[model samples]
Target: MSFNFYKWLQEQDDIIKKGVLFICDSLFVDCNFKGYYIEDNNLIGNVLAPQYETLKQYKELNPYTNTEHIRYFFELTKAGIKHVATVLSYERSKDTMQVCLEEQYEYITIENGVVEMTNFEPLTVLIKEKFKL
Candidate 1:
């Protein structure tokens, strides 16, 4: 079955919507994405990581202007952020990278949506460090 991002997004709770947007904005700025678009039921984009020679060089040249994107993700769970989000890349298909939140006061359920495009090495590092992944 084909996925419908807009339909799925509208069905989600407010916090999940916010988190998805947060991730998109973070990737656009941090990873130097050309732009975002929906394709085959997935949000798709390309990152500029391949243009750089080395991860260190990428890190040196691009310092995070704002830590709130990364910071807010870490606080999502604590602050009662609910739902599940998966951050994936073309290169790391085997790795299931997730930042989980909550749903229902009695118990929490994690849901998956979105697909990370390209190999955002530097941005991945920042997210890993922030989320302690």
Candidate 2:
């Protein structure tokens, strides 16, 4: 039987997806911070909002102030970039990687003596074969 690597990887636990996004974002940030030109800084965040939301909620519930930001920080380190590259290699070798878009929005309203409106475009997964990394 021919194995479908992309499907298999997608079926892996949510950690895999989260880890991938985190690493991607970290790498982008590191590159930009080092004065490298980046086309879109929000690309990773937009694609991975769902996963990020999950991780954020998890941290929020746990509520440890100092450690709480660790996840965010992790997504922007050299180690994070290396990890992302590794995962992408695995994903590409299997030929089951694609870029997806997730449309996200925030409401503008007045609350707690402040008015705010924000919009987010998150990254997502699509059913396809291979991505240029």
Candidate 3:
């Protein structure tokens, strides 16, 4: 997570940099909120949430300048942000690393139907039950 966070920092736009920095700090250092709890302690939770005031502040801002993780990057700064909060699996095979938001009210689910045509990776989803806050 540290490596990925550092990589993202160097590549992100200057405007979004602060939001990205805050998220990185919260995730890698000061985690003050609980988003969710999962099996084996794997947590996928909220990292940032947009405020009505911030919405006005960002309304005049330009769109993200890059495409990598583009959808999430913008969502994090101007709207609601969610992420993989923690992974406590020991065997390395006990992590699900995902949460479906199809019925969740806090999220706006986008189904482009593009990835539906891809093949399966024979991966393991070990969580017996997923909990959201």
- Find the candidate with the highest TM-score and give its number: 1
Backbone clashes under 3 angstroms, per model: 1, 7, 0
Tell me the TM-score of each prediction against the true structure: 0.21, 0.18, 0.17
Model 2: what TM-score?
0.18
Q: Cα deviation in Å at residue 43, candidate 3?
A: 25
Query: In model 3, how many backbone clashes occur?
Result: 0
Sort by lDDT, top down from the best: 1, 2, 3
Pitting candidate 2 against candidate 3, the one with the higher lDDT is 2
Candidate 3 C-alpha error for residue 71, in Å: 5.8
Clashing pairs in 3: none
The parts of candidate 1 lying over 4 Å away from their true place are 1-5, 20-35, 40-133
| Tens-digit lDDT string for candidate 2 (1-133) | 0124223433442444454454345324331111111112223443331133333343344343222011111222342432111112132233222222112212222223221111001221210111213
Best by lDDT: 1
Worst 10 residues of 1 by lDDT: 65-74
lDDT of 1 at 97: 30
| Candidate 3 per-residue C-alpha lDDT over 1-133 given as tens digits, one digit per residue, 9 for 90 to 100 | 2234224323432323243234444333222232212121222455343221222233234232211121111111112433322211111221112222222212111133111111111111211111211
The C-alpha RMSD in Å for every predicted model, in order, reads: 15.8, 18.3, 16.2
